[model samples]
Target chain A: MIETKNLRFSYNGMEVLKGVDFKGEKGEFIGILGPNGAGKTTFLRCLAGILDCRGVFVRGKPLNEYSPRDLARIVAYVPQRVEPSFLTVFDTVLLGRRPYMGLTPSDSDIKTVEEALKRLGIEHLSLKRTNEISGGELQKVSIARALAQEPQILLMDEPTNNLDLRSQLEVMRLARELANDGKTVVTVMHDVNLALRFAKRFLFMKDGKKMADGGLEVLNERLFEEVYGVKVEIGEIGGVLVVVPI
Target chain B: MPMDYEAYTRRKAFIGLILFLSLLVVSLFSLSSGPYHVPLREVLGILFGGGTKDDRLVVLSIRLPRIVAGILVGASMGIAGAVLQGYLRNPLATPFTMGVSNGSMFGASLAIILGAGYSLNSGQVFLNNPYAVVLFAFLGAISATLVILALARLRGLSPEAIVLAGVAMSSLYVALTTLVQYFANEVQLSAMIYWSFGNLARATWRENAIMGVSFILVFFYFILKRWDLNASTLGDDIAKSVGVNIERERLVGTLLSAFITSVTVAFVGVIGFIGLIAPHSMRLIAGGDYRSLIPLSALAGALLLVSADTMARLIVSPMNLPVGVITSFLGAPTFIYLLVKMEGRR
Candidate 1:
């Protein structure tokens, strides 16, 4: 649903994204894996249309050509860390419906927000202000907001950060379910094992470049060491692949 | 279905009602509060054209317009402060943070020293060249906004830097005002000091109409953009993700806030603390949802300022204290108590 050809971005004079190419299709759950400053977040922001960059296309249209409202209707992004403010969890989630709302929220908008919260298992916290919630709950609030957006394409940066083991799995499972339900889901992740557990495709990045792109075959000791500068033993536990650093 | 969304919304609605009713109550109380002390029944009777001519004069001609000015200036400052704080993401921000009040002060002081001074006698005050003072005060307020706008446009200041620039601008305006005061003789200096005392009594029906129009137009504009403001408090990425053009909205919101504040301050002089207290108080009582906040703050602002002005009139009887002084007296302690409560919660 979205593709980029030679996408380049820079902050000041320092180039952060160096001609990275990517194409995401419907029903594809792709995990972008890289260490610190792999241009992962930058690439996700470019796809999300938060940054002004050329050569990024959504459904064959230039990203910059779409108005913010039109683009938001089709593409929703969940950032790495969503700040906790004085907003109730329900209202914060209702913000996702903004692209489709008039001045006042409609009944459908409110219903969708409630359903989104339920999906994230945060329905009980709906009345609670975000500042009163925990880190993991806040992250789910962010994801719930994105889910409420009802976008065709979802881009998440570190969707699992600040989440506990169970919440992380639940969120990753939700992303996978979204992909399976005919939406394109792309997440930039730090935990290789968690990505392997749910994400169907993996895109490895390093030094502002795409290091490898594929499934399990793309992952090996050499690439892991070269990309993450670590020695890892990739093994199976309970028929699921897990990356353990030795 | 599992959530208590109905209860939450109902609670907010209730809060809005209380604020609205309290504002009405305080306004009526202020009407009967001045030197003549019109009774509440006579005040209502005056409204229906059944009171004494003397009572009618005291209630309608003198007090009604001042109450209207209180509502106008107070609501204007309140919403302006709320919008400013939201757009800038700075809790410390008010229209005053951008040097609006100080700039008006500087302008009025300059006018007075330059021969626009009027005599203060027999517990009455007048601006001999009122138009000149208003024009200069407005120009001064707009100048502060322009300088800050230029800083953002030309140099691309971060929101934090813009707030700092506002503080520096305020320092500059204060220094310039003091310099103006330095050159003033005794009468001119006292006039300048009195001019700094925020006076709702200065508003006749004409001034009230202008202030009312400005507040209504600006209030509607911000209310229409409340969702974007809610997204704004979360920061840029999410705000953009939600289809808000944060930059454009920020600029427009800032300009409008500065515009409304300038229009009010030019007529009423510098009313401190109403702007700061109203918005923050509403935020604490009802969370900072701009949907509720924008209106709630307006009510709270009107309620706070009119009450402060009334107390200023009633405290010494016959002689009036500066409304700004009363606002500071009410605002500082209340704000401190809120901060302590907020921090204690954590």
Candidate 2:
């Protein structure tokens, strides 16, 4: 579980998160939807403890009190884009276990990495250099790396970017399964339908403030118009609610 | 798609064995090489204390110390370069990039010009008070590294900032060294110039022992931090996400690298190219894993420098060319070849 109250962050004297408040629980799939400059990434980074902020808590403990290693044990974050390096897919995934590993990787560490790769269906490319992989495969590799952490909370920024339709569905399905298995999943997404289909809890942000929070009941054409300045028709497709922007 | 971890381990072991053997051959060749050629048989004989006095003197007193100096200095530079490149995540990072060489050169030049008047009780001023030059060199290097670190701290420890600070500090030290050179007398100027040429000929048994001990200590320290280095190469943000204390690790790693480089430079002037080329060469052979890359770079560096120093001795025979000169000639071409080969691969 994670909680934040009055969390404020600033850069160059400009406030990005203006006294924002949030609460998340285990086994919950949460999607954050926002327009440009809605402070979505900054909020996620604060929750992941990547940026220093006040009034952020994880499992009833203040985020600042946790050491980096201790925080890594409970939370994993995948950034928007990772630069390709000389590391192999296996090694990149294995780096996720760095907090738990010794000078050399233990047998269990390697096993965990292998399992993460398998879970992401990327075991076939484990030995390939990260630079030699395709964009979609690299995205999965980054996810696999975060999965190797085996954390209670997962934070992903634009996880579906560069992925094909099938891969996107597969990744969303995987996130659903992970939440069903009792892991907290927090993702910042631009695809409204994908978020609606996969995520059970929705949070809409506007101008660095939380505009709405809850289930499907919180979403409406009026809220969409206010947040995104776009008129949208909400309809059901295959018994799933879909938002169509006009 | 499972990895054959056993096979991978065996292959790395094989490569390590071959490198160790190559280093052995080069070491033996270096032992047997000099202005006065001591035969391989005599070199071996002297090792077990059964050679003639002249052969023993040549092999043990002169060539042995020089060979050890080359190995220590080369090994330190190689590992230091590897650590810097990995920690900074920059291929161009080398030991001298932190201003260690320039700082040591300034210190050595200062001692050469100023301490020429200082005498010792033994009446052998140069040998008896060698510590004056080495101490100054060590202080100079440490102070310059500290200044670079301070600037880096002020600038958020960004790679570009650290590099810029180091370059500025390096220019400052070099300018100060030139000032010393301008004010030097004839003997002091030549002595200072010879010191900067980076010859192992000045190696003494005591100095070799000191360097050997430092090399072993620093090598083990780096090996212990190999995992951190691997995580660091992924960039600082990811390194932090993976639980690495990026700032602490970067500071400590850079300081250790500068320390090793300073000690080597203090002892053996300013050897060029070994630090810059050794890690790149090893990365070409091995992958980017720091565990294998660090030790492999050490062996490769020791091999390259020993062989180059041998050529420096034999190129014009009795009049020895500075080993530094030979290294630049050999290293630059090899580096260019690697770059072209890498580009071709892409």
Please write out the lDDT profile of model 2 over residues A1-246, one tens digit for every residue. 999999899987899998888998999999999998999999999998888789899999999999999999899988888766666788889989988877878889999999999988999887666767888898998899899998999999989999999999999999999999999999999999999999999989987899899998888899999989999999998899999999
| Candidate 1 C-alpha lDDT tens digits along A1-246 | 999999999998899999999999999999999989989999999999998899899999999999999999999999987867778888899999999999988898998998999999989898788878888899999999999999999999999989998888889999999999999999999988999989989999987899999888888999899999999999999999999999
DockQ of each: 0.72, 0.55
On a 0 to 100 scale, what is the lDDT of residue B58 in model 2?
Answer: 82
Which regions of candidate 1 deviate over 4 angstroms?
Answer: B118-125, B344-346
What TM-score does prediction 1 earn?
0.97
lDDT string for model 1 (B37-65, tens) is 88998888888888988999989999899
Please list the residue runs of candidate 2 whose C-alpha ends up more than 4 Å from where it truly belongs after superposition.
A238-240, B1-3, B117-129, B340-346
Alpha-carbon deviation at B231 in model 1, angstroms: 0.8
Q: How far is A149's C-alpha from truth in model 1 (Å)?
A: 0.3
Report the CAPRI category for model 1: medium
Q: Candidate 2, residues B46-148: lDDT per residue as tens digits?
A: 8998888888888888888888888888888899999988888777677688888899889988887776423334532342346888888877877788887
